[model samples]
Target: MDKFILILANSQSHFINVIRISIFIVMVWIGGLKAFQYEADGIVPFVANSPVMSFFYNKKAPEYTTYKNPEGKTVQNNIDWHKENGTYIFSYGLGTVIVLIGTLTLLGIWFKKIGLIGGLLTFGMSLVTLSFLITTPEVYVPNLGGDFPTPQFGFPYLSGAGRLVLKDVIMLAAGLICASDCAQQIIKSKNSISVNRAKF
Candidate 1:
């Protein structure tokens, strides 16, 4: 475990590329599960809140309505957007771009240009996830119609909007780490190329 942590902490270009690939694969797997409601895994928060959950609950085409905010305003959850817009559209549109860029980084193909695009995509996801983690609870959970809504899990740490939000923050941090590493590698590669040309 120490060795594993040390490798990740070193945070080199190759290591960061591995991180990007791993994150994307996990995202894709989660999205696929969201696309098809398999068994519920407690680790996945979005899937639990999905319209697909209604199926698990034995409903006939149940609509996913989000909990209202403290201000009594309705909001759309992430699963709602995924269902309405179509998972493939969201996946290929944003997901494919990120994955392709990440794959390119790992392959060392067009490192500077592709890495820039990958870093940008990762940064954008980081920002979007950060917003979801921060703003959505204030806008949705208060409307669950209770002094205090029941947590998703039995334990405090395992349940509650705060815990879900914390997970998103963790994902955002991972994206940022990937982006920073890619950007640094891009710059370093450019410098190396220039140095090689100068030597020639």
Candidate 2:
């Protein structure tokens, strides 16, 4: 038991690396999906309602509600509307950024500077995503009238979208951990250089 405890205590660095790889896998996979029409359309509510991102869309929020397309299902009218709204274009740009961040984060295994940038970027992205819970009305279950009182519909009750966005909290923490590790590495490298210089 003592030996096992010691082993686990010394594995923090390895575990942190694992977290970095995990973030990479998740970012790349989701980012790649953004290329699809369905994926592009699905993010309408979040982007349209976002105060920071709304400028990317031609159409406004609430207007997006009427044009919402079910995932993996398509309507010509909806597709046309999305095109006019720059949904696909924005999605492509966002996807590219996400993939690049992931690649940089993964490269942290070999290079600290790039890793630090990636880590901070990931944190920023996660913060934006989590903000959707507040900005996007679709994140919570609507008060759809039922025979009985819909007690579960409201702010405390999260919709599927909200739940999905909530998962970003983990990514937020992982980003900080990765950033801290990279920062430590950079400082250590600088200190080594200083020591060598003093010896000369």
Candidate 3:
């Protein structure tokens, strides 16, 4: 039993590290996907099939257009969200912010503080996504697919946007784990500092 406990304690760090690394990888990948036009094809289908996302699919949303600068011969960009409703702006703005948060968190340079922020954002998004799934059941089912005509959530069902939805949910879990670990470390460090000060 003593040996078992020792092994478990040692393995805990490894497990935590794995979870943190995975979260970092996921965030980086997502940021890359959005920043660069790489393999973004999946987003459209997933969005179109998702009941929640379908609303935003065919939106003739006005986008930022760029005009060539006469002198610099470079494109001048401007925001045209005025043409679209707040939904588009909110979604776009939140998305960009989330990506930035994830990137900063992944750096591990300011682990505790940034981890907490990332975790909160992830938790909020997860709750929102899950709630949306509950509110819009029809969107849970895919409009096109083979073999599995209907989405089988199995056991404790989860509403997902699509394949990517599951990924996001998993990523969200990773974020929470990272946050918890960071918080624990912060508390431990503060307690240690207090103990040393008392000795002095």
Candidate 4:
């Protein structure tokens, strides 16, 4: 038991690094997906509903307003307009930014300053994503019992996309941990240099 504890303690830094890399993979993969039409279309509900992000869409409607479908309409007109209004471009741009963040974070394994900056960026992005929980009603499972206002499936009862966005909470925490670790490493490096100079 003692040996096991000691081994676990020794592996803490490695575990953290693994977590950091995992976040990088997730960010990069999801970001890359944004460049595609399907991915862009999928995020429409979340973005369109957000007070801060609604401007990205061509037509601004209320959070739950069902757009009128034209007669013989096989396609969703609102979504079509959304795609035409540079949704793909916006998604591509966002994807590029996310990929950049992940790249910087991965580089942090060698460069502390770069890593710290990447960590901060990742943390900020996580906050932005997590905000969707409050601003986007689609994140929750709607109550089947109607007539009255439908109660949302809150917290642990997150719907599919809700689960996806909620994972950002973990990413946010990981980013903070990585940034703090990098800062400590930078400080220790500086101190070591100072001590070496004094010895000379």
Highest lDDT against the true fold, candidate: 2
Candidate 1 structure, TM-score to reference: 0.49
lDDT per residue for candidate 4 within 126-193, as digits (tens), equals: 99899999887667886666664645456556888898999899899988888888899899999999
What is the number of backbone collisions in each predicted candidate, taken in the order shown?
1, 0, 1, 0
Off by over 4 Å in 2: 147-150
Specify the poorest-scoring 10-residue window by lDDT in model 1. Answer: 35-44
Regions more than 4 Å wrong, model 1: 1-14, 37-112, 137-162
Candidate 1 vs candidate 4, lDDT winner: 4
What does candidate 2's lDDT look like per residue over 10-115, in tens digits? 9998998998899899999999999999999989999999999999999988898888788768989989999999999999999999999999998888899999
Tens-digit lDDT string for candidate 3 (14-54): 67667666666665556555432212322333333446555
RMSD of each: 9.9, 1.1, 8.9, 4.2
What's each prediction's TM-score?
0.49, 0.97, 0.56, 0.84
What value of lDDT does candidate 1 attain over all alpha carbons? 0.47
Give the C-alpha miss distance for residue 5 in model 2, angstroms.
1.6
lDDT, candidate 1, 1-200, per-residue tens:
99998987775656666666666665555544432322121213342234432222322221223321222232356445434534333334444554554454343323545655555555565555445443332223443344556543222333355554456555566666765665677788789999999999
What do the candidate models score in CA lDDT, each in turn? Answer: 0.47, 0.93, 0.53, 0.79
If both were scored by TM-score, which would come out higher, candidate 1 or candidate 2? 2
Highest TM-score: give the candidate number.
Answer: 2
Candidate 2 residue-wise lDDT at 135:
97
